[model samples]
Target: MLLELRQLRIQPGQQLLLEDVSWQQFENILAELGEHRAARISYSHGFLEIMVPLPEHEKAKEIIGDLVKILLESRQIAFESLGSTTLKSDRMVQGVEADACFYIQNQAAVIGKNRLDLSIDPPPDLAIEIDLTSRTQLDNYQILGVPELWRYGKQGLKMNVLENGKYVESNFSPTFPGIPIIELINQYVQQSQVSGRTQAIQAFRNWLRDNI
Candidate 1:
C-alpha cells in the first residue's frame, strides 16, 4: 500500500486541505509523500492540511532556527534538532510537522533511538513555529503533549505552555526559564531583516554570552 503511493505523483503547492480523512488514509499519504518532500502536513481530529511553504515563510523559519541553535550552543545545553520532522501519535489522533523542534530536557531519552513513539518516548521539549502564510492549530500540539510552543508572527513572538490538555499564554518560556524569550527573539528577528541572517546570528551569540 505504501509502495503504491510512492509511484503516484502528489504535487502539493499552496495549501491542500481535506476534511473527514481517516487516520489510516492520512498515514498512507504521508508515507507516499516520503521523507525528502518539501512540504508540510498536519492532521487534527479528522482534518488534514498540506502546504508548500512560500519564500517569506522559509526566511522566517530559517532565522528562528538559526537563532535557536545559537542559543543552545551558547548555553552549553544538549539538544537534538529535528528540522520539520514528522511527529504523529495515532492514539492522540494528531499529527504535525513543526518549522523546527528540539529535544533539550529529554535529549538523552531520544539520543540513540531511530524511531520515536510518542506513547512511550518524550515529545520535543520545545517547538518553534513561524506563522506568516498559515496558522497552525495550537490544540493539536496540546493533544500531542508537546510541553512548549513558541509562535512567531507579524506582531511578535508568543510563548505557550501546555497545561492539562490546554495551551496557556506565557510571557516566559518553560524550556528556558527566566529568559526574556519574546524580547530577545523579536530583537534578532527584526535585526535579521536588516543585517542579514549570518550577521544577526553572530550579534545574538555575542550578546547572549555577555548576558549569560
Candidate 2:
C-alpha cells in the first residue's frame, strides 16, 4: 500500500490527505513507510497528512536548522538535533513531525537515550516549523506540551512560547534569551541563497562574534 502511494502523486511537493483513519492504521502506514525522509507524514486525531515538501520548503528548513546549530555553537549550548523526527503520543492522539527540532534545555535528560517516549521523557525544548505550503496545527503541539515553537511564514519567523499550557506569541525565545532570533535567522537565510551557504554562515559567525 505504501508503494502504491508513490503513484498517487503527479507532481513534486504534492499533498495527500486521509481522513477517518484509525490510530492503529496510521501506525501501520507509518511503519510500512519506515524511514522515508522525503515524505513527511503527520497524524492528529483520526486524520493523516502525507506531504512532499518542495525544494524551497526544504531550502528554508535546512537554513533554519543550520542557523539554529550555529547559534547553539556560538553560545556553547549543548543540544541534540532531532532533524524532522516524528514526535508522537498514543494516549493524547497527537502526533507531529517537525521540520527541525532540538533538545537544548532538556538535552541532558535525553542525551544517551535511543527511543523517546513522550509519556516518560521530555519533549523537544524548541521546534521549528517552516510554513511554505501546509501549516502546522499549533494546538497539537500545545497539547503535546512542546515548550517553544518557531514558525516561519509570510510574516517572518514568529516565536510562540508555551505559557500556562498554551502557546503565546513572544518577542524573545526562552531558549536563547534576549537574542533577536527572528531578525538574525531571517537575514542569514536570505543571505545564504544569494552569497552561498558557506560565505553566509561565515558572515553570520563573524557578526555573532562581534555582537555576542
Name the top TM-score candidate. Answer: 2
Candidate that scores best on lDDT: 2
Q: Give the Cα RMSD of candidate 2.
A: 2.1
In candidate 1, what are the lDDT values of residues 6-48, reduced to their tens digit?
4534453377677898999998888778788777888888888
Q: Which stretches in model 1 have alpha-carbon errors above 4 Å? A: 1-13, 132-136
What digit string (tens of lDDT, one per residue) describes model 2 on residues 89-161? 8888877788998998899998777667676778999998877355446866888899999988756788999
Q: Looking at candidate 2, what is the lDDT of residue 109?
A: 91
Taking all chains together, the TM-score of candidate 2 against the true structure is: 0.92
lDDT of 1: 0.82
> lDDT at 19 for candidate 1?
83
Question: What TM-score would each prediction reach against the true structure?
Answer: 0.89, 0.92
